[model samples]
Target: MSQLYASLFYQNEVTEIFSDRALVSYMIEAEVALAKAQAQVGVIPESAAIAISNIASTALDQLDFDALAVATGLAGNIAIPFVKQLTAIVKQNDEDAARYVHWGATSQDILDTACILQCRAAMTHVEALIHQCYRTALAQAEQYRSQVMIGRTWLQQGLPITLGHKLARWASAFRRDLARIDAMKARVFTAQLGGAVGSLASLQAQGTAVVQAFAAQLQLSVPSCTWHGERDRIVEVASVLAIVTGSLGKMARDWSLMMQTEIAEVFEPAAKGRGGSSTMPHKRNPVAAASVLAAANRVPVLMSSLYQSMVQEHERSLGGWHAEWLALPEIFQLCAGALERTLEVLQGMQVNAENMQRNLECTQGLIMAEAVMMALAPHLGRLQAHHVVEAACKTAVEKGVHLKEVMTELDQVKAYFSAVQISEIFKPESYLGNIQDQIDAVLQEAKGEAK
Candidate 1:
């Protein structure tokens, strides 16, 4: 059942990148690259490096995944059995060259570097999706730069704000997420190449040289030391992903709330069989938002597990390292799924300008009380203005009349302000102070980043 519905939840592009075949291929690629690096450093024969690459490149299709799974169960790590199978394949071609296949390397070196390769690949897709989402949101903000809507606080009408201002905030979030992702590349993309004890003891005095060569071969940065005991890189990647997912969740929550039948201010783009209910004919649920929220809810928990795994015993971890095998990939998958869904929501979003206008009036000018208070603050003292507006709001609510009507009848308000000024105070557009400036700032910064 999980496999059947996997495509619905996870992206096919990212799924293929982290598939079993891709993982095994990465491990083999690590082995081949290591051999070449060792050869470059004169630690292994050049013929052996060539032979390892040649055999392992073709051996992927021939390797039995079921057999590898069983061997992994017994060996405690996939690299142990994987290396044995790779060596056997190389030995079949050139027996003498097979001896140097994985010389001076440990299973952790292969596994960790392979995982880094997978992360590097997955992040490319993630970054692209983030860019798409960012651009879509920025476009929306520009398109609706002056479209006024009621800003809600604690689920009640608070004040007037433009839809563009709200979307600019989302664009800014994705922009910051992109910055975070770019900043972490140096820390997270470093190569892992330490022998059994992370000292490269097996490689002797030439360990550092071999590590440098290995990293160069894989186009990865060499870490200051082996990360067998240190899990900061892994934790950093997971933490950043969790933060991005959380931002996506906030967008989804807002969108779903706006789609409520009573509110009906905005909606997910409509399509046949997209968000339809099986029994109810009128249902148009926010399915993409729900999926993004599920990912947002689950990613932090998985990120916490990675944090827990940071505690290791001695030179290596007993169960801590093992815990990462499932958690990290699941994190990547869930994050990818969330990013894709968020992009979908942004691209196909439906905005109801008329509904937004109608909803703004539902409060009968109560949402503009602050505007009235501020306008009257100069004539009446600040405290007196607040009290007068407060009383008028109460009168308006009790009598079911517009606050503008109630305020016009107030003796204090009529004493300070003309009828023209009183009418201007109630206009939602007039009360939207500096919202265009704020939106323009966000758009300008985002465009600068693009340049």
Candidate 2:
């Protein structure tokens, strides 16, 4: 039932990557690669390696996930039953090949390598989606480069800022996420080929050679040491993923607030029955924003489990490693879902420049009081100007009149500025200090980073 929203959050590519069939198929690929590597180092027969590789393609559908689940519960891991099923299948083609199946590799070695392959595939899809989202963000920043809106702090209007200022921030976050993913991949996508207790004592003289050959066959990097006990590399990927989802949540949060009926400064692009309430006809909800925000809210708690699972017992752990097996894939799935939804939102977003202008004006010139304060600061002391404007703002709120009008009548304000000068400071457009310069600088910086 929870899968009802799977299509809304994730895509077919994500399903294919983490599917049961793909999982076994990857494990089999690891087995075949290990056999081939052993043969390369003369630990197994070349003919047996060829036989295992030839038979592995048809072995995917034969796996019984139900049996594997029961075995996993009894044995404390899935790799035990999975390797048994793999060996049984390979034995039908050549008994000699079956003898060498998973030779010198422990269950952790095969399982960890398979999980890395899965992550490699998942990251490919996620990176493509992130790149798409980043490009859309870049387009929004450029299109709305001078689109003006009120900047808010603590849910209240503070000053006038360009829409590009906000969108460029989104662009920069996703751009940096790409680098985090790459750095994590370099550390985590390496081979995990240590035998029992990470010593490879079974392989002995051929251990490092088999490890190198396995990495070469899989096109993954060779690790400096086995990571059975050190889980930080994988945790780094999960942490980066959490941060990416958090960034998406922030972007959605700002846009969702702007879509409010009272604000109406921006909106999710509307379509027939999209974001419709069952009872209400006028609702155009920010559905993507809600999904991304939910992912953001949930990922941190799940990531915490991954971090807690880092404290393993010396060579192996009783419950900690199993915790990671549960959490890491879930972290990937949640982040992938958020990335997919955010990409859709950014590509189809609607911006209302007129509504932004109205909202800025709705504040009755109080939003521009900071500009007036600065103007007065040149003549009066900065603190004194702040006091004068603060009093005028309170008076405007009390009388329900514009702050600019109240300020003109104030003696302290009249002591410095003329009518035209007071009006200039009140205009929201006049208060855009360095928004264009900031936008230009960010866009230029994003261009280099995106490349």
TM-score of each: 0.98, 0.96
- In model 1, pairs of residues that clash are none
lDDT by residue (1-451, candidate 2, tens digit) is 0579787665677667777778788889999899899999999999999999888878887777889989988988888998898889888878888898888888888888998899899889889989998888888989997888999999988899888888887887888999888877778788899999988999888888999999999999999888898888778878988999898889889989998999988888788868889999888898888888988998899898989988998986778888877777777787888888888778888888889989888979989888999999988999998998999999999999999899999888898889998888787778788877877876787777748
Question: Which number leads on lDDT?
Answer: 1
Q: Tens digit of lDDT per residue, candidate 1, span 194-294? A: 88989888889899999999999999988988889899999998888889889999999999999999999889888878989989989989998898898
lDDT of each: 0.90, 0.86
* Candidates' RMSD to native: 1.0, 1.6
